[model samples]
Target: MNNETTNSFIVQIEQKQLLLTALWPMRFEQVQQCKSWFAQSAVKAGTLAYGADRVELGLSFANESFTFCYEDYSESFWVTADSAGGAMLLSELAKEFSSLEIR
Candidate 1:
């Protein structure tokens, strides 16, 4: 990506504090899959919300907004903003969940 696009994307990302391609929610059932994936890592996820039919994952990592959160109520996975170094960390995490099905 060019500097302009990258900078612009970064601006947009900061504005929203997330990296959502299209704002579509995931299926609630995917929580099971997400749980399994998260379990493999030692990182602890913060609970944003939860109920009989809803749950939300929120966590701040390394004193940054770098988090991989999923909301059962909204059924959406939200990627928090990350620095260049954080991106590298996320890249490694990505290798484990290679088959992320976005809905």
Candidate 2:
């Protein structure tokens, strides 16, 4: 990771906020997974939308113009942009999606 390409981001959902950090080596892959997660999770959380594949993820919340997609070759599960809100929504839906449990 180099100083120029590394980036940090913050996502706010309602009153909660989350911080995310990424670097060049995995930025593209991370962005893709984040978008995919946002699309699927958002839909599941009742934030229904027509296009999941077209959703975009960003490394910075300041600018919102980056396009993202899933990269099957990635090795991690990362979320981005609206993830804070998406996480809260998903957390609320988890109770309804309860098919299994752990102790």
Candidate 3:
């Protein structure tokens, strides 16, 4: 059972109190290619969140809320939601793949 997270992004818009994220193994190049598609998906999903190359999700009554961004150097993607408080909802939004932890 491999349980390591990849493909993550942090969607943050604190100025609006809306936070969202994703935890999937989406490569930086991949994200770069599908920026428009991701943005449109959020809109279609009714999140209405936007960014230059990322997607932001608004806080929803269902308890999932987040805003995301990318860090190219570390190849790190993050999702920030209060988890125990349904923040994981944001985490769930990610389309990810699983891999064994390399230690």
Candidate 4:
């Protein structure tokens, strides 16, 4: 396998952190596809937590040109990224992806 480090994006909603890192076979078009997938996905509330009022939410974004994943939650259903700390982390990764040259 290639040892090169591919670019990846991370998501954090509240205290939960989700990572989305790019994989091998770098290609600008492929990266763009991933970016588009992220934009198209709808962030829905996850499941109920143990003893909190917070609701977990699922973040579905592109892992590659043809892959995706549904993040897990511990104690919530819906997460707010507009005014959450994790938004910044996600933004940073997006910015990094934007700067990267696909291949």
User: Which candidate gets the maximum TM-score versus the true structure?
Assistant: 1
Model 1, range 15-100, lDDT digits (tens) per residue? Answer: 32443332344466655444444444444455544556655565444454455555555544445545665554553333333333
Pick by lDDT: 3 or 4, better one: 3
Order of candidates by TM-score, top first?
1, 3, 4, 2
What candidate 2 gets wrong by more than 4 Å, as runs, is 1-16, 21-25, 43-103
4-97: candidate 2 lDDT, tens digit per residue: 1112322222223222223224444234344234332322222222233332334222222212223334422223325444444433332221
lDDT of 4 by residue, 1-103 (tens): 1122334332232333333344443343232233343442232223222222222223332221111232222221122333244444443434433344433
Candidate 4 lDDT at 15 equals 31
Q: Order of all candidates by lDDT, from best down to worst?
A: 1, 3, 4, 2
Please provide TM-scores, in order, for all candidate models, with all chains considered together: 0.38, 0.21, 0.34, 0.22
Highest lDDT against the true fold, candidate: 1
Clashes of each: 2, 0, 19, 15
Model 3 CA lDDT for position 11 = 40
RMSD in angstroms, all models? 7.6, 12.2, 9.1, 15.1
- The global Cα lDDT (0 to 1) of model 2 is 0.29
Q: Over all chains combined, what TM-score does candidate 2 have?
A: 0.21
Q: Candidate 1 — which residues are off by over 4 angstroms?
A: 1-26, 29-33, 48-55, 59-65, 70-76, 82-84, 99-103
**Model 3 per-residue lDDT tens digits across residues 6-75:** 4333344332222324545555555454334443233222343434545433333254444444455544
Candidate 3 runs further than 4 Å off: 1-63, 82-84, 88-91, 94-103
Model 1 is weakest, by summed lDDT over 10 consecutive residues, at 2-11
In candidate 4, stretches whose alpha carbon ends up further than 4 angstroms from where it belongs are: 1-19, 35-81, 85-103
Candidate 1 lDDT for residue 6:
23
